[model samples]
Target: MGEPNTILHAVRVSLRMSQDELAQAIREDGREHGEPNYCAKRNVQRWESGDVRMPRKIYIRSLERVTGLPIEALGFATPVFGTRAAAQAPANGQESARGEVVEMGATSAPGGAVPMTKHNDHGTLSGIWLSRYEYHSSGRGADFTGEHFVVVIQHRNKLTVRSLPEASSNPDSPLTMDLTVDGNVVTGSWREETAGDGYYAGAVYHGALQLLLEPTGRKMTGKWVGFGKDFDVNTGPWELTFKDASTSKAAMDRYNHRP
Candidate 1:
C-alpha cells in the first residue's frame, strides 16, 4: 500500500489489541459519541496499511477518544482549510486547537492542555481512587474486606474504572467498572476475573452497581449485587474514595504499600 501508517500500527500494538479489537473499541467510542460506526477489522487493516490516510470525521473523533491522542499525532495529516478543521473539532463546547482537543473549562498551556486534577474542581472523575468492598464468604465464615488501587477516567458522562496491580510480581485481581452519571446518582456494571489459583478457581463474576456521589464529589458509596461462587445472589457494600489526582510514582507507591 502506501508508506504504512507505522504510528497507528504502533499504538494498536502498544495497547495489546489486535486489529479487530481496536475496531471494536473505536466502534463503541463512536456509538458513545452519538455517531454510530460500523468499523471492521478490514477498516483497521486499511488504516494501518496506509491505504486510508485519513478516516471519516466520526472515525477520527472516535480514534482520538479511544487513544486519547490527537489525529495528527496518530499520523493523520491535518486539514489545511479552516472550515474542515472547525468541522472536525470536538463538539458540545469542546475545542480543538493545534490538533489538541481541549476539554470544556480546561485551560491550555503553552504546549498542551492543562492537566485537569482534583484541585481544578471541574467535576471530573479522572484520577486515582481507592476502592473498598465487602463480601460475605461462606467458606471464610465471615465477611472479608478487599481493596485495590483503581484508575478512573471520565469521558463525557461515562466513568470507567480499572484496577491497578499492586506490584509487577503480584498482580491485582482484574476488575473493571463502567458507570454512567446523572446528577448525584451513578449506575453501572462491574466485572472481575478471579485469580486462577484462588479458592474460586479463576471464576469470572459480574453484576450491577448503584452508587450515590456525595456533594463533595470526592467519595462514592454504593452497593453491588452479584452471583457468588455457589450461584447464590449476594449483595455487598462498595465504596470509592478519592486518593490521588494524579498517578505519579509517589501516589502509586503509597497505595501499593498499603496493608
Candidate 2:
C-alpha cells in the first residue's frame, strides 16, 4: 500500500519461502556474522500481514547480513495502489494477480505456464532439497501410505523426467534428490549409488518422477506420477504429492550427508 511494504511482499513470495523459514534464515545469518538479529518470527509475520514497516536500513542490513545477496537482487516494489490493469502488469506479458498486464516471458503452455529456471532466487537448480513422506502399498491390494515427493520437468507441456527415489525410513539407508521446477511442475532425479552391503547388491538404481501443481481455494495441490528402476525392482505409480522445492532440498541434503 505504501513505499517498501509492497517490495517486501514480492521478495518473500519470489523466494518461495515461508515467513518463519525466512526469519530463521535471517536469524542464522545474524548469529553467523555476529550481528544483532533484526526481527523474530512474529516480526516477519507482522511485516507480511502489513502490520508494520521495518526501517529501510534494517532491511538492507538484514539482506546483507543473512543471505549475503546484493541489494539490487530485490526489485522495487510496485505500489499496491493501482488500477486493476496497472496492478496486474509484470513487465513482459506476465499478468499480475490484480489484473495489471505486464510483459511476461512467452509460455508455450497455455494458461500461464512458464518454464522454471532455478530452485531459488539465486538462479541455480541444486536439486530436490526435501522430502515429506514415503508411500508403500500395503500387502492388501489398492492400499497405500501417505504421499511422497515426485519431481518432474516439462518444456511447453511436454513431459520430461529426471529420476525418483523412495523416502528413506531407516536412518541407515536414506534417499535424497536434486530437482528442477519449471513453473508449476518440477523435474529432477537422484540415486543411492552404494548400499550398505552387497546382500541386496544395492545395484544400479534410477527412476523419474513428475508433478503438476494447481492452486486450490486457499492451498496448492498437485497430481504426480513416478517410474523407477531399483536393482531388480521396477515400479510405477500414477499418484503422488506436489511438494515444494524446499521440502525436496532439505530431504536431499539430509540423504547426501547421512552416514
Candidate 3:
C-alpha cells in the first residue's frame, strides 16, 4: 500500500492506456465473476495518487487480470498475505480429517466468502464458448454440439452472440442479449431472429439461459430453455467450455469484419 502503487501506474503508462481505458478494461475483465465488481476512473485516480491508503483487493486482482501482471509485484501484497484457496467439501456427513469447516460461498475480499480458486469465474468472459447440449422434448431427444462467440461490449454488460452451425443448428443466426451477471452466475435472455413462414418463423422465441461462471471462466455449466411457436418448451443441460486461439478465431473474425 505504499509508494502509490508505482508499479500499477508504470504498467498503465507502458501500455499507453489512459486511466479511463484501464478502468473500463478492468471492469470488463471482472464481469465473469458473477455481478462483476465495478471500478471507476476516479477510483483508479485515487489508487494512482495514493489518495486511498489501500486499493480494494478486488481492484488489485482486476488490475492483475488486465495488465497480466502479478499483485505481489505491484506493491500491494498486504491484503493477500494469508489468502488461501477454497475447496468444496464432500457432502452427506463427509468430513476432512482436519475437520475444517468448508463454506461454499466464500467471497473475494479479506474476511469475506471463501478464498478464490482457479475457475471461480474471476477471469475474462469475452471469448468463444464451445457448448454441448443434450435436450429432451415430448417424445424426442437430441444432442447438439456447436460453438458460440459472445462479443462483449466492454463496461456495458451487453453482448452479441453468434453461433456456428452444426447438426440442424441455426446458421448465420445472430442473437442479441441482455444479461445479469451475479457472482459466479449469469442469467440472461436473448432474442433470436430467423427468415421463414409460419409459427416457427420471424423472431419466434425470446429464450433464456442461466449459467455458472466456473473457476477458469472457461468452463460453464448451465441450462438453456426456449419456448417454441407451439408453446412447447424444450429444456436441456449444457456444458460451455472456453476455446483458445486455434479454436476460436472464426467467430471473432466474423465479428470484427461485420459491416
Clashes of each: 0, 40, 13
Candidate 2 least-lDDT 10 residues: 154-163
> Which tens-of-lDDT digit does each residue in 43-104 have in candidate 1?
78877765555676777889988865568656543333247666665432222332223322
lDDT scores for all predictions?
0.67, 0.39, 0.50
User: Residue 240 in candidate 2 has what lDDT?
Assistant: 31
* RMSD versus native structure for model 3: 15.9
TM-score of each: 0.53, 0.28, 0.40
Model 3, poorest ten-residue lDDT window?
Answer: 100-109
TM-score of 3: 0.40
TM-score of 2: 0.28
lDDT of model 3, residue 176: 40
